[model samples]
Target: MKLRNWLTLVFAAALLAGCGSPGPPVDPAPVGDVQRPTPAGTDMSGQVDNSGPAAPECNPRASLRPDDTIRPGSTMDDIVKRGYLIAGVDQSTNLWGFRDPHTGELQGFDIDVATEIAKDLFDTDDPPIRFRAINSGQREEVLKNGEVDIVVRTYSITCERMQEVAFSTVYFEAAQRVLVREKSGIQGIADLGGKRVCAAENSTSVDNLTEADPQPAPVQAANWTDCHVLLQQGQVDAVSTDNTILAGMAAEDPSTRVVGPPLSEELYGVGIPQQNEDMVRFVNASLEGVRQDVWRARYAHWGLGEVLGNMSPPRPVYR
Candidate 1:
């Protein structure tokens, strides 16, 4: 079989394997999960939106019900019963969650989010988290089959995805954007006429860029890093992806930079299996903690201020 065909087959088999067994149902209860306030107040009114549509206000409290069977304090019990907090993530998306060459350990923004949840459950700030490297298409399936307890792979919360998985409140916000060589003179998506643009296969970035006005040829790469390699080699004029991922790429390559404004805005939510309300609530609370206590610190440590601007301390937006 061809290489692309082989990869497709492997991904299909992984999804099939992930659908065999449903994990234990979440407990229903209104236990007091800790709620930490965001350091900076949320003001979406002033937030810019260059992407497809503004995010609808989702009710975080709706995911938490007072009559829920599982009480708040049961988060640890659930994980202990399950043995490990199996987190599905992308090991190739740098700055979010990638395997470090020196340590052979997964590290990034998403990894930190998972670590926070593990800490909340184990009462240790640095609890060990087992990661299952997953592709964009495999995230929901991994959660469905109990292959992973949570997915923190820069997943965007969409109505369609909600049908298959429960998502926590918006922990991090990102936008679809373009990245180009500093000397390419490509200002934004509008400048891509007749230019070759690359995006990850099976990603929303491909769909969005392909449907743009000028309709530049959309090349598919196995991952964003692969797409960046193509761009560096002059195989493509520009590469497009989430702003966070693109920023990380730019950090690695001084010759590259993110161009123009964002094309679309998206919210990053932690993925839990659908109907796992207890787990959803618990994870939501954990996200609130990250947004308040650790988000800004990590962003600065990761040098994200250049791309994200003064939004280092994320403001909470609960509806």
Candidate 2:
């Protein structure tokens, strides 16, 4: 048999073998064609429409100056009065913001950051906060529609996004990279031409992968974990995203490894609504304390130091 055909047969066999025990005795002959299950809201077409209003010509990292005190009648005050802060977050991106399977609770670097904001707003170490699970594409939509007061799901600060939402100062800095199977023979973005690379829909990873010189075909999944799944199933040639996120996926799967040099620098910021400038300032102020006091502890607690290295919190930049 041809190598391609042999690989395909092996892939199909592995899928069938992992589908739990045989439900009942069956005849030797099987039904027609069995298809692979595509994740919900997955887009295999490599086309991504990025058309929109041009972003303002300002430093994306330069945010509103931080104020130590929250003003009366401000967005922060409203959140305080409401008893709990609503934070939009990702429940799948392992280390950044994922649900702990053991405790059935949300915890990660992003969750810790959001908790710091709530603590500052409510003036308590243990603050009342509700985490609303959202996917990559829904981060801006939830903030715009008031579904969540803030989004901390590894949200990168970009000029184009500034038109749609407000952002806090940079809290974490990550670099874009590639993840591939151990023997995939793919070294970096340079080796990806004509191959399938998967990323979450509307994520910076998709945009960066689409713009590579020898671009691969883009496969959009609902989340990064889904991208990891696609890679394991032999559906995609590689997964491309921030090294911070790729580290999480790599930790979960031992057969994969991250390769290539950094493609781009991604500065992460908290996502807030465009109209809520007060809240943005409040978050920035809260981040000032977080960077100094909480960031290192949370990073160590999550064991990110082993994979991501010991890095200081990103220094704040004010407009």
Candidate 3:
């Protein structure tokens, strides 16, 4: 049978089987054999002598302004009044914010960004940044309700999303991609026509796959981990998501690999509720700090060198 016909039959059968039950969660294969790098410890206490006079402290809260106010208008006031910066993030995405088995603390690229922002606010460079776990669908709501001062999840900047929240300058550029078994013989998105594919629910992956020319039937899982499980079980032919995410999945399971170049460009940004100009400015400055320092170091430490490359030393793009 043609691949298309087979996919259609499977999708029809899936619909008959009911389409709303949540799929089982998929965990990445253990990092047992992979020689993962060790995380860089918090050691900024006395290491400054080697780097010369460090850059002027960007923390503005320490000094009082000419008008006798705390640096004119600042988000510091809001944060101080609230007592803590509530950050919304995903704890399930490995290399982004998955919980560490030993400490039970969330760790990833996004988590590092959040910690930097908090450090600037507290002027400690190691302040305690509080994180609130949020799913993809709840990011907007959490920001709108003031449940979180900022969202550092892998949120893409899109026209529709801009209406609900303001976005910082692009911090990381990623692309939609496909992952398949090493011997699956699938080359790219074009070959997914007759194959079953999976992606996280409420993610751009599903939308992009749904709009493909061949229109593959997408299995929406609660998370990419779940989607990976479906692929391993031979229930799906491909898993679609950001190339960075697929890379993480492949790192966990050498039997699977990401195939083909990126399908579409995606720029990640920090999200804040719309009209909060103060919050937006604070976040932009904090992101600038991240781009300048610690960004590359974190990627290297986290084993993301293969995907991010030299993009780590971020060039400033102020708007």
Candidate 4:
């Protein structure tokens, strides 16, 4: 099957099969055979660093002017003229961006955000929108190369990333946490000092996990579902990333649970090309509208309210 078509079937089958009932305990060990990199300590803190060199780092917020611009001759106009919004997103993060296995349809919270963006851009929720499934590593490339109009994946806004592209105001907030089997005896991230851990390639979790004081031997995968497979197969001791992603993993594997507290604050933003400041403002305006009610309905529709609690959406700020 093609990559996109295979994604939903592969993940849904794996998770559903693995989560049916309790499984045997796992004995995690140091993963020495996997290709890995050195730790960067606390330097790659995954937060926006304003103290860096004097360059135009991306502002965490979009223009807060009550009257924002999304007029003709802008990027928004270009997209409108094109008659469709090409979005880069994930297809296997479950509640965040997974495809529904049963229905073979794309659906998730991030997917909903894309739908909303399309709805506002073309004045109809049925607006032509296409989804391209990209992994953590492809988030920046897709936008930089003009492969997509915007990226709504669980992309964190960082100073380093800001140097490469632009971001709208935060639409959602997440925290990095740990996911381990129920009987893994792992209580938190601190306990994974010498154990092998899995994180998505080119992701903040990789640097964060590697930077642990004692440090975990890192295993890289293309998606959280890959990490989920490794943990299920007892190939890795733990997996770490945003709690939202981990929550999906935990839901898939009944024997696994999200352990440990938050590792870092992650703000999810709509990634636009550096030249599309107008598009950024338009997306920010759309986000403001969604914050009023769309997010609540989305959260409920995905049944994510229980795992994430009552989220009121992130407040908007200007650069």
Candidate 5:
């Protein structure tokens, strides 16, 4: 009888405890897709029309004085002291920054650029290069938070982005184009009207698609590789982005080919956090040194000729 009374009291105590009220239901994390921020007053309408944002000249703010470059004892002193260069780069953007599937080693045009910068900073490109693999959405946050010293992953220089980070003088120019399955019958951006088009979220490529004449249904992915998957699965009709990127995707899948005229001009620059103007100048000087035959050899080495196609190197325009 005492044991029964004790059990009844324990049950009553359990009932009084806070396990009775279930909290609000929790949602599962989003897979493959994320909510990307858009500018205030971003047109939600997927309508394509002639009336769209005017295309800028794609010129960045003037670069720092090339003659009087950033000194080693300045901002770069800390990076050297750290013993390794911390670079934020894309690990999936084909010729620009993808890792080799067989060797599992990072290799790309941007990787080469980062190597050159490391060589200049540390006196040897073979030094420890700690790569932080990040996607388009993470670029600004990573730079702003000091998560990386520099970003060299096919990053474009933009007036808006300048507010967050400083960029080296333009080193490469890429033009936006469309990629479609060879048999899809889609010729270009104009042909994408009413079809599903995939572009990386927070990329200017989406904006280009939205401004097309007969709008496509936009599908946003976390990475360009995700868009490639969607295209192969027939979930998206076409993938549109810089031709430099499209070329890399095309190389991966023989069934897909880059089609269409240029949609936008992408000026590639090395991204440095705003706090490190010295690093910016240091990077710019490295670019100037590699601007000639050196960059050409890299483009040829990566088979970027299909996209770059005799493109001249961009000169410095200092602010």
Candidate 6:
């Protein structure tokens, strides 16, 4: 046989030898291992300096007195003319300011508090308002940048923070505490000596941890929920923050519980731009009115009494 014919016959035999009844196609093995994603700005390793000159001593709870007079061209006047109040809020902090999974509507004590302000501003039960969701670290930045007219998130008042933005009278007081798995053998902050604990970056919780006597390694996440994720994934041994936040986390995961004595007293206030004194006073006045009735009702509505006990709103103090 010719060489060409011989080669062709060999190829035909090879094809015939390989042919068989075909079955369902099989997927190839995955190329790489899947990794659960952490939220943006998560920092597994970061250091906080606790040695800074003790932030200029001032009573963080004291703020300007309530003023209902909205002068022409002032911040409140502008907001009134705009027809809708823009508020910065959180959507993942559970009872404080979280989204309702069933209705897809934002509902929480903080949301209600912000809504009360809007209602009074427009003089209606259903006021024109818009809620802008933001992370814990973005509270001051949003106010300073004028991205939001007011930040009603769990924004703690601090002397350092006061320099950049203004605050309304204290609205809620939360205590810093620790959250750990029920059976993690970690009973309190004393037990967290060398363990990794998670808190959102730029939060006062990190400072508390770093300033502790036997400091546990502090890991920073982008949000409080991200800290919860770290706790669940075993990336961190505990999550520490405000009691209100820790209570929400415990409610979300029954396997965990808040432990330890309070690390610090955190006084939350409405964040406003330094230039917007009129807005601050207006919000203070709104808060003053809310404390009379709406605050207590909303606190009970969010079921906070079960976790935080029946509590009254913090009284406003003027400087």
Candidate 4 lDDT tens digits, 1-319: 7999899899999999988867787889867776443332212222322244654555655543433466768788888898899999999998989888899778889999988989988998588999999989899999999999999999988877888888888888998999999998999988988788888887888878766777877777777788887778787889899988887887777998888778888989889898887788788878888899688888888777667677779888886
lDDT of 1: 0.76
* Clashing residue pairs in candidate 6 (N, C-alpha, C atoms within 3 angstroms): none
Report the C-alpha lDDT of model 2 over 22-73, residue by residue, as the tens digit: 6888669767887788788889887887775667687988999988677788
In model 1, which runs have C-alpha deviations exceeding 4 angstroms? 1-76, 312-319
lDDT of 1 by residue, 261-302 (tens): 777777788898886777877776677778778988988877
C-alpha RMSD of candidate 4: 17.0
All models, RMSD in angstroms: 22.1, 13.7, 20.6, 17.0, 10.2, 4.8
Predicted structure 4: lDDT: 0.82
Please provide, for model 3 over 1-319, each residue's C-alpha lDDT reduced to its tens digit, 9 standing for 90 to 100. 9999999999999898886767888999777665332112211121112232333333211111112123534656767656678889988888987899899999998999888888877777678678999877688888888788889998887765776777776677788999999999999888988567887666777778767877677776766777777788776888899887887888888899888767787778888877666676777777777877887788788788775455554344553
Q: How high a TM-score does candidate 2 get?
A: 0.88
Please report how far candidate 6 places residue 116 from its true position, in Å: 0.7
Residue pairs with backbone overlap in model 4: none
lDDT of 6 by residue, 189-236 (tens): 898887799998888999889877688989898899999988898888
lDDT of 5 by residue, 1-319 (tens): 6999999999999888857778888999879865455333333344434354544454474667554243557777878788889999999988889889999988899988988888878876477788989988798889999999999888877876776788888888888999999998888888888888888777788877877888888777778888888788776799888888899999889999998889888888889889887788788778888886488888788888865577667777776
TM-score of 1: 0.75
Q: Can you rank all candidates by lDDT, best first?
A: 2, 6, 4, 5, 1, 3
Q: Tell me the TM-score of each prediction against the true structure.
A: 0.75, 0.88, 0.74, 0.80, 0.80, 0.88
Query: Which pairs clash in the backbone of model 5?
Result: 62-317, 62-318, 62-319, 63-317, 63-318
Error of 2 at 189 (Å): 1.0
RMSD, model 5, all Cα superposed? 10.2
